[model samples]
Target: MQTQSSFKTTETGTLFLVPTPIGNLDDMTYRAIDTLKSVALIAAEDTRNTQKLLNHFEIETKQISFHEHNTQQRIETLIEKLEAGDDIAQVSDAGMPSISDPGHELVKACIEAGISVVPLPGANAGITALIASGITPQPFTFYGFLPRKGKELTEAVTTLAQKPEALIFYEAPHRLKKTLQALLSTFGVDRKVTLGRELTKKFEEFIRGDLEEVLAWATETELRGEFVMIVAGNPAPDATVSAVATESLSLPEQVEAQIQQGASPNVAIKTVAKANGLKKQVVYNAYHELTE
Candidate 1:
């Protein structure tokens, strides 16, 4: 129940979330440049990588490391500085902060401390690839990166497969083939997909086709740079069938049924819990017949 008036005058310093260029330097907005030059301190994901951008823009503002590994350690210090009315700007190596980057924790801390959080929108790879993907872009979900583990990945993809909106995912070149294969198995061979490689760069390329075609192309081609994948939604989701299948079964029985269909216990619990609008722990406890 907290309201944030971004431009309102306040004694505490504002925490600016600045976006850097995803690929093309020309995409960097003037506002982003001005903020970078003006902030008291720049909390960057990687100081070395960000220094290159600072040098290019002639921004001499100092930077402190604020990545995943050092997030908890840095939040206290950053909050202290903001409380003292020294404005700070946070940036990632590229793209918007906290969008698959390391600025979320700091942003949360700032909110909790009642510091102003100002976001300057600029380059974003997900939306950049989406518009040109030729897929319906209105109802799209930006799923940053999928779980890397086998069981976890299966559960995540299974849940996302039921959604009716276009799904966007980011993947490294090394894991591109495996992720595409995972999507092929869950989304089926005929699902429409587009793969944008090295987006906004000189060697940018887009592959548009069905899942099967994209999988084949990934197998034969040598992948380089990062990629953005746009997967078409399920055109004919059978929600009625799912509802009917679970209505007659007890919660534990419903979980058992999913396991019989080859889902792991955790995955089965998640599916049944989501279907019944209950928590996973509740389903897990019921399925295991735990008294506590």
Candidate 2:
């Protein structure tokens, strides 16, 4: 258990979590700007991008690069500065820090070192899009971004498919069609979906409809901005039946059942692994041991 008094004066300085605007510079809060201006140093996901926001607010605080690539190399330095009583502010190019952005590691370091962390609430693309999405707002899961596409992507989507809560995902313009197609294929065409693009900007738009309808719309339209995909919760019975029907079978029996259903060993292993929420290698080893 840990307690934090953000304003308590101590030898170590505070780590202020500052949120920048997702779009529309007017969204910048007065407190966010003041904290940025008052901090001893600023850790930005992209200094070049953050510089523009700083310029607009007339905040001259110096910023250092602290992105995904350099997170490991930079966390220690940021922690050291905090320990030295130099209050620091961490910001991403847009939105709050550490929500599919860099800053989580630094924040973890600060906590371990007993440095104070003060978070200033501001813009967040997911929540911003959610309120206007016409989808069930509460009891939602914010899955920042999907994997580009591979085994990881498959595993991620498969895991989320079982969730009963509304799903929120961020996707790039280029991959919008493909992701929508994947969602349609996995969740079925009739599933409800809402896509928010160019959020908080001049051309902001939301496409709300069934998966197939939105997917068709995406295929025909020229996707031009960042997207927030809000998918309806799983309807139940389908996921439950598959899971329950397979639970009665032993691991090897489950593997053979899939194989009898025309699945190859690799495919069967992957399927059973995902169904049981076990690692693929674990299923593979057990299946091989039964065969051996």
Candidate 3:
């Protein structure tokens, strides 16, 4: 076991956790491609899907299948590669691999094995949506996707309802309406929400409003493409001494009042943004459109 020979030739390969674009191919970072090219092997959630990306860049590096169904069995093979002096890379079908994806097990196994792991930052649709939603992102929690069952979904959403720093989640097109309903029920009928659909794509759209308004918008629109939802955090209950009491105003209405309180146009816009856990720019645009 601890032989000098074992330590010497052991490659101590680096594991590159690459982040791919959420929608647009142009959003893919150069570093990610470089890492993919240089890695000896890539553990991809889906090989065929990643092959398209590889073909686009002409990266011929071979990929090993390591999806949710096969992750347990593949971890051993992946670890062996790392120990044998071959650097490896991991990527999901889209976005970051470990954030609600199947690559988490590999990351944890690498950590326990004492292998060095490096993560390259790039596009994250969930984060992009949260920041652009004009919601207070700091101290916010990420719940990648909601459970499907009525009972389990309720429990999951309800657990994070008390957070004061907003909540972020991802949802598929078919499940968005149901998840929105769950969010409205858990956070209260009046909670503010920002919904980003088809982010980083031409069809991208952002909807900002209280629960009822946002839910209505979702119902009225054609639900297409991936969805990212940023919900307002629970604010401190009103104590009553000339406090802004952001919770007092409806989301759209509060975003309106920050301007009336002598805050600059931008400040007023961002005030409601932070209060409801969204991006300043998104709120600014909503204000502009609503007033127009």
Model 2 residue 15 lDDT score: 95
Per-residue C-alpha lDDT of model 3 across residues 1-292, encoded as one tens digit per residue: 2212322334588788998778899988888999899999999988999999999889999999989999889999999989877899999988998987888888889888877778888888878998888877887888888778654664565456667778888888887877776666446666789989989889899998887788787788778888888988878432111222245665556545544433456555544555466776767777677552
lDDT for each candidate structure: 0.86, 0.83, 0.76
> Against the true structure, what is every candidate's RMSD?
6.6, 6.0, 13.0
Candidate 3: residue 111 lDDT (0-100): 80
Angstrom error at residue 218, model 3: 1.8
Over 168-243, each residue of candidate 2 has an lDDT whose tens digit, in order, gives 9999989888777656544656678899988889998999999889989988998898999999888772452243
> How close is every model to the real structure, measured as TM-score?
0.83, 0.83, 0.76
Error of 2 at 54 (Å): 0.9
**Cα RMSD (Å) between model 3 and the true structure?**
13.0
Stretches of model 2 off by over 4 angstroms after superposition: 237-292
Clashes in predicted model 1: 0
The alpha-carbon lDDT assigned to residue 207 of candidate 3 equals 90
